[model samples]
Every structure is written in structure tokens, then in C-alpha cells.
Target: MDWKGRRQSGNIEDRRGVSPRGGNPFGRGGMRLPSGGMRVSGMSFKTIVFLGVIFLVLKLIGIDPLQILGADPGGVASEQSSPSSPRITEARKDEMTQFVATVLAETEDVWNGIMKSQGLEYPEPTLVLFSGAVRSACGNASAATGPFYCPGDQKLYIDLSFYDELAQRFHASGDFAQAYVLAHEVGHHVQNLIGVLPKFNQMRSSMSQSEVNKMSIRVELQADCFAGIWGHFTAQKGLLESGDLEEALNAAQQIGDDTLQRRTQGYVVPESFNHGTSAQRKEWFARGFDSGRLAACDTFNNPV
Candidate 1:
């Protein structure tokens, strides 16, 4: 991967230093006790009930008192920063952050051209960099949750430490593999733009758990295919080195639900597989790599 000195994305939100624990639990809501009881201090029982009534009334009218107070709900991580807040750590002395920005820029280039060819405008999604935990419009997540795309905010949340985990823990190491991860998440953003995710979210609630899992396999495999589509364009630019494609394929293989299940549990449950098996993932990615057309990456109708 000849990524050095390449164009970098400016759509990065760095929240590495912000503590997951914001402040004042009761400021938003009453304290949550260990025994599952609410504890409100400096207020009587009647006052607490009165406040609760007020909260309900505000909730019914779609107003949030906390927002009016200019504070995040539940004292969670916030986008707002202050001089008193924790200082954000600099981005890795120009290593991980630079690589991520370069890759994101490349994805933007590929997708922009493809979308324009289809007579559609591509809306670029922001990528967020966090350390331990971060908050999105969807919810809060820790680094252990891995990388994810939040349709609610049109942002991709990632903790760069996951790259090390990918290499050491998953045994799939390469710059291209890292790029594949980002591209896969960006593929989800593309799905969101094309209404695929909206349809899935709308229909999944009425589906059985097993049915949802099966559908999820299709969704994830399609993202893998989309990643490969990005790879195909990247290769045309003569950016891929020898074994670069294999690195991505191995990454797709290593993170497959079947492979992970076998690794962690020593057995595989086909019914519980949501992200497809190793062979399925690699196959879908290879399909997109071979044929860069959008029609080649459909995992919903055809076999995955």
C-alpha cells in the first residue's frame, strides 16, 4: 500500500481524551442504586414525585429539560468541550490517524466516482476517533464493541487500537486489511444512502430472531462485497502490492462468524451465524473484486 503523502480526509472527529464518565448522574436523572432503586438526594419524596411528573410532561411534549439546560442526557460522553475538560491526545504522531485519513479519502474518491456514474450525489460520512468509549446518536459504545457505523448520525466510530487487535488477536495483519475494515463500514453508509438499511431496519422488528440473523448474514456479506468493490478501484490505481488482496481476503475469513465461533467456543452454530462463514465472506468479497458492477454484489436475492 503506497499510502504515504496521499490526500487525507478532514471529516475526523477526535474524542480520544473525553472520559466516558461525564459528570453528575443525578443532574440528568436520579442516581441508579446498586439494588435497582432510584436515589434522589436533597429532595423529599413529594418533591421527587413532582419532578417525575414534570419530566413525564416534558417527555410527552417531545421536549427535553436537560437539553434546555445544555447538558447531555445521563451524563454520558458529549461532543461539547471546555478548557476544564480532558485534553484530546494528539493523533499518534502522524501514524494511525494519517493512515485512516488516507484510506477514508481513497474510499471517498472511489465512491464519489461510482455514485456520479449512477447520476447520484455521494454524501460523505464523518469518521470519529475515540479511545475507550464514545457516544453516538444511536447510543454509547466502548472500544470493545469494535468499529460500527451509526446511521442515526451518519458517522463511523472507531478506536484505532482495534488495528492492533486485528493483527495480534485476529491474526490478520496488513495495511490493506485495515483499509478493508474501514471500507466495509463505509459500505454500510452506502447501503444507508440507497435505502437498503432503512428497509432492513423497518422489516427486522417483525422478523423472528433466527430470520433476522439469516438476513444479517446477507447484509454483512454485502458489505464485504462492497469493500471488495472499493478494493477493485484501488487496485486499478496501482496501489495494491503483492498479497494485498490476500490480506483482505484473510481478514474477511478471520472475522467470519463461523471462524470466530469455532475459535472462541470450539464449535459452530450455523443457525446463529449472522455474519456468514469464512468461505461465504471471502466468496462475496472476491465476487465484487472480480466484477466491480453494483449488480454483482447483491446478497439479498441470490445465494450468499
Candidate 2:
């Protein structure tokens, strides 16, 4: 991908070493247990209620709930302190981190230029690198939740291990595929900045679950198009190598909800398809890449 020796974004927040375990009173820990000291593996409802009562009592007394729970409000607290040494188990893994930062920087550059041309400002979103589990302003998520962009914090969270899964499990290999993943999440951040998500959320309140899911498909497909818009810029700059576009297109096809569902459950459910079919994903991405104009990427205005 020719990412080496490129500028890396300084917006990276490395939380790889922080254990998802240990009770964090401040609600900032990577691995957050439920209220009242509950654990993921096992936690009784009775205990949850008991802890809830205690928490309520503490709140009623005007006490800092986290202070009573023995958690440091400042940062992740652990007896085996030191924010885990920067450990990259493999050379490839280290390179992947560099690649992520580089791609983020490139996105910033591309979006900045595009926004500036339109008389708008582009505020860069922070990229958070974590492992296992992490907490976000939106919610806590395990690595299994995949990469996501949190509108609440204007940050993108990723567990690089997902790249391995993308290659091995989803059969979506190549550096460009990995780049597309980050770009897609960044597209969500862009949507958040422009108020698409807020409008969707407002509209969703009046819709049924199935109806909301239908709208969600438009949202996701738009992000795919946005990713392709980034690809268009990169290609125009001659940064894309041969077969790079194919890698991204293949990735879009591979991760479609229909494809995943068929592979897992041996069937497909249209009503449950929130991210569109493989054809839709590939089409929208191609649409954006072909026409770099943001107006062409409006899935909501046009049919998906």
C-alpha cells in the first residue's frame, strides 16, 4: 500500500495494554463490569439489585460513586501499573499500526481539501487503538463488535485483531481492504459531523424496528460510498496500486449481511438486513469512486 515512511496521525489513543478486567469506578476502563461489581462471566440479578441500591444510596448522599468504588477517575487503575508497555508481538502487526495511522492522516488530508473547497471545516476525529474490550462515549464494546465510530466522542475505535479476522475469516485480505474498513468508519464520523446520524436518530424514534433497520441500510450504504469517495481521491493522487480497487470491492462483497447470514445460518432474512446486500455495497462504493462528488453518495435521497 506504500504506507511506510508516510506521515502518521497523532490522534491515536493506544489502550492495548489496559486489561478489560478489574473494576473501574470511573466508568472509563476498557473492560467495564456491570454496576454493583458484577462480572461478565457470572453475575446474579439479586446482587445487581443490591449493588444498584448501594449506588443509589451513594448518589443520594452527594458522594462520588466512583470514589466509593475505589476506582481512579483520572485514568485506568490497576495494581500492576504502567500503561502496559507498547508491545507489538509481530513485525507485521507493528506495520499495521503504522499503516492505520498513515491512512488516518491521509483521510484527514483528503477530507480537509474537499471540505475547504466547499467552504466548510473538517474537524479530524481521533482514532482509538484498543484490544479485547474498550469503553466509548457511546457504549462499551468487545472486539467482536467490530470497528465502530462513536459520535458521542468523535472517535473511531478499532482492535487491529479484526484485520486478521477480516483476512482469515471473511476472506477479505489486502492492505486496501483494511484501509476500506477504517475509511468506512471515518465515513460514519463524517456523517455525525454533518448531522446525518442525528437526523436518522430523530427519524428512528417514530419508526418501527423493521422500518428503522431499512433506514439503517441507507446509512451504512452511504458510508460505503463515502469510503469509495476517499478511494477516488487516493486513486487520483496515484497512491492506489494495481488491484487495490479490487481488494476494496471484494471486501465490500465479502462482509455483506446476506453473505454473512448465509454462511452462518444457511439462510437470509431481508428484514434483518441493515447494511444492504453484497451487490448494493459494491454498487454504492463503485458509485462514489466513479463520481467523487458528495451529492452522488446520497443514498437517502436516491434509492439504494
Q: TM-score of the candidate numbered 2? A: 0.78
lDDT (Cα, 0-100) at 260 in candidate 2: 79
lDDT of 1 by residue, 26-79 (tens): 122110101111122256789999999998999899999779768875454553
Q: Model 2: per-residue lDDT, tens digit, 99-193? A: 99999998999899888998989999999898777777766776766787877788888888888888887888999999999999889888887
| RMSD to truth, every model | 13.1, 11.2
TM-score of each: 0.77, 0.78
Clashes of 1: 0
Q: Which stretches of candidate 2 lie over 4 Å from their true place?
A: 20-88
Q: Which residue pairs of candidate 2 clash?
A: none
What is candidate 1's local distance difference test score? 0.80
